[model samples]
Target: MDHRSETGHVMFLSPERVFYAGLLGRPRNRSTGSLLIYVGLGGRLMLTCGGRTQADLAIALIPPFVEHTIASDARSSLCFTVEPESVTPAALDLLARRAADQGPALAERICAAYVRLREGGCGPGFTTEELDTIVLGAPLARRRLDLRIAEAVARLNDFSGPAATAADCAAAARLSQSRFLHLFKQQTGTSFRAFRAHKRARHLLHFVNEDLNFAHLAQDIGYPDSTHFCHSIRRFYGLKPGAIFSGSRDLRIYRGAAQAEATAVAALA
Candidate 1:
């Protein structure tokens, strides 16, 4: 039975990862602050960047916040989003090697791991460690995010009911606006504005499979209107909210992380 048909609920995959697996339409261009690894199950996955077809891949790794398009005949895929600040040098090296290799060993490992999860129908949420092991060829020590930047990112993720400004993050991070702006980019590998926007846009995941009013959900996620919401989300996820909703009618979402555990414990209480 479809879980969404009953409650349209959301579940955690891990603290740093959340994904929807099921039928999905071809994605439009999008980018995000986390590394995106995808496996096109049941069909070929094509990745395009800079107006050229970069890879016709079954499994692939895309670095954080890089613009790209996904085209596939596959009805379903597994998308893993790892917080970039937590990415290891080894992992980065592996991603780079895999990105340049047509038949990288890393891709095969990632594909195999994703197949297991996909065959399990999106349950058994994966740990960030498992994701690391699959893509990096070994478990690498998690790189720590800059404390100030991490605080700011957490503040942004804490609440979507209100809009947060760059100044707010700068203040929360306890840095001069100018310094915060510079350091944020240097630390997070994305601009402050884009990072906040992507974080807000990422929250849009919780409601993707819901039948709520787009305009209302837009505001709930701090977008000024439906247009901005659609555009911003597409800018990151490469698909519009409506298109995603339609395609993921029976979608299975799994979230992961320490955050997910806390949410579970709270619910039980």
Candidate 2:
């Protein structure tokens, strides 16, 4: 293993996802809201899960909120955390199951995209949607969701206020608590609470670059107390808040290309 990838670089950050290129110091075991695709850009990596180490991999796909650790040589790597529903299911399953080796092909495309960005041929680098499209090829069949349930998901994603409860979601979707709960699980393949928590946890992404301390950051993101904030961070990212926050210190966080551009403009203003 190379000892060179100890340096880390963050390329983009948003509420829904983030992309990183460069060395990632040891990451916390916190679960994340979106699916994680850790692409090995240079040296080989060692991914540890459930007390085991998976080394010599070109890429790894981790499902949301599943705790794991990655040990890598100090080499360049590219990573993206993509929104669950926004990514095509076929692509997600392909990487997650490890049923086949798509690593070489995926790596080639990523390298090309990186090269193009470095040459300033494009602006804002690659995006989650673009990467998903590149990997998945054509569109795949989507799960048929109840319109009401789908509306509820939209609301969940958009809601910025207090933590939404099951009752609240049911009301928003215009369904009884029981019926809505049933449909939500069937349509989304996860319990309502888990889905909502992941959505809520994603709110922390916006503040990744803020100067605020944990207390204020927690409140600003709608966590009830420090305890809840810490717990939520752990569950979402599988690591302690302090570790995650400290690890991201040098990251140039952004919500999107527009937000990043706006921030740059404001700095000059």
Candidate 3:
């Protein structure tokens, strides 16, 4: 697994897997496929998952089935995502609440304890008691609607392109549109449309930087036309696609010309 920033990285852990830890750079729409316990050591990062915003100076204990996209500041950060299935749901819920409350000190302690367990520093039977202590000390109990909204936002990472409307998302959550909107704002502190747009923009930026196949990238990401695509690029980044790729002069369009060139190169190679 390449954890390097420019090349994007992904790791998969089976249900039995436990205590996976590492240092990560600014991650874009990278799926963990399990619960993630991220500790931000240096600069702040903006993490959009499950319709929630996990931003600056915060430690995140993400739940399973959640999708996360992270953008780091100038400094790099250390993050760990552990599969929490081995622990009781009560413990997991407690940790999630602590992270939501931005309890970095408590998060750090938990991480340290986890690392010790992974490294054989602690005996086999110690985990249950330790987790209980941590959970008891941490703040717990948040609204269920808030957690559901966060789960919805996290689901976006599974999407390869553009996102469904708030109504669409609300329906998926089995809630009315109005109720979903209210809960989404209350939980994540941002609107559903805004969250979707941010996720799309991040995906677009990744495609741009990676020089991915433009047309497919556009369609994969949910834009009907180059005009709409370009408009979105401008709206989010404040720069036209042309301006973004102006000097370098690769294919100006994301679809036809660029795809043709890439196809030809692949055939020849």
Candidate 4:
């Protein structure tokens, strides 16, 4: 028998296998014997699974026989599933009695462990056990508006040349244009347009060495015309696009400046 096929079957039998496998974005096809818990930290997520209202940092303790889908707004996450019969009776009873407030410290630890795991570092052996303990202790809180907005801002840090509009960002966030603008301002303490322009300027500084066509770069990043794009760059960074990319300044200077600006904006958000 193929080990891969057997592995699939075994995934349903053990809670550890079930929990870790869920984190990889694929769940076993059958939900009849699984319970899933989603803990959102700093971003927005959309769940396709039948559930209550959509909100930031939403948590759903899905019982057996329910299937769900989850989407997040450029933020990291930690999710797990438990086999119905694998969890101790004591653990199930605790989960039934707890409220959402009891999961922050657990969330924090999970987030930290996830980061370490992503970086190829050795995570503490007790991390998963601690996570299980937290889930049993209390309900996990929802994500905050400020963190979601900050995540939006962070996404822009990778943009270069020209900036996208609030409407574009709203579509990305899956929110109404008006609501996105309001929420963006509330969380980032800046207008969406301003933040986008800053992001574009930072990208241009980083990519100026590449023999990219200004017009194409502008259009690629959502600007309508080269003239308008250059004008925006000049107004914000006090340097025309051509002049900055002309090789006058040391490449290191441009890189350092851009990184500093991006860092400052992130900190502000």
Candidate number achieving the greatest lDDT relative to the actual structure: 1
Clashes of 4: 5
Q: If both were scored by lDDT, which would come out higher, candidate 3 or candidate 4?
A: 3
lDDT of 2 by residue, 85-160 (tens): 5545675686566424767676566555555433443335344444344434433234456788777776666424
How close is every model to the real structure, measured as TM-score?
A: 0.80, 0.76, 0.38, 0.37
lDDT value, candidate 2, whole model: 0.63
Over 219-250, each residue of candidate 3 has an lDDT whose tens digit, in order, gives 77767777777777665534566554442222
Candidate closer to the true structure by TM-score (higher is better), 1 or 3: 1
Model 2, runs deviating above 4 Å: 1-8, 13-17, 95-99, 117-128, 131-144, 257-269
Q: Give the per-residue Cα lDDT of candidate 3 at 160.
A: 38
Residue 83 accuracy (lDDT) in model 2 = 67
Q: Tell me the spans in candidate 1 whose CA falls farther than 4 Å from its real position.
A: 3-15, 102-104, 118-126, 134-137, 159-161, 261-269
Candidate 4 lDDT, 1-269, residue by residue in tens: 43322221111111121222111232222232345655664654555555543545545455644555555553334455553333454565465444255545545554554444334332222232443443343222222345546556545654432355677678878889989889886664456776566555445544554568999888766668899888776654345677656632222211223344553565576
Query: lDDT scores for all predictions?
Result: 0.66, 0.63, 0.49, 0.48
- Candidate 1, position 24, lDDT: 44
Q: CA lDDT of 267 in candidate 2?
A: 58
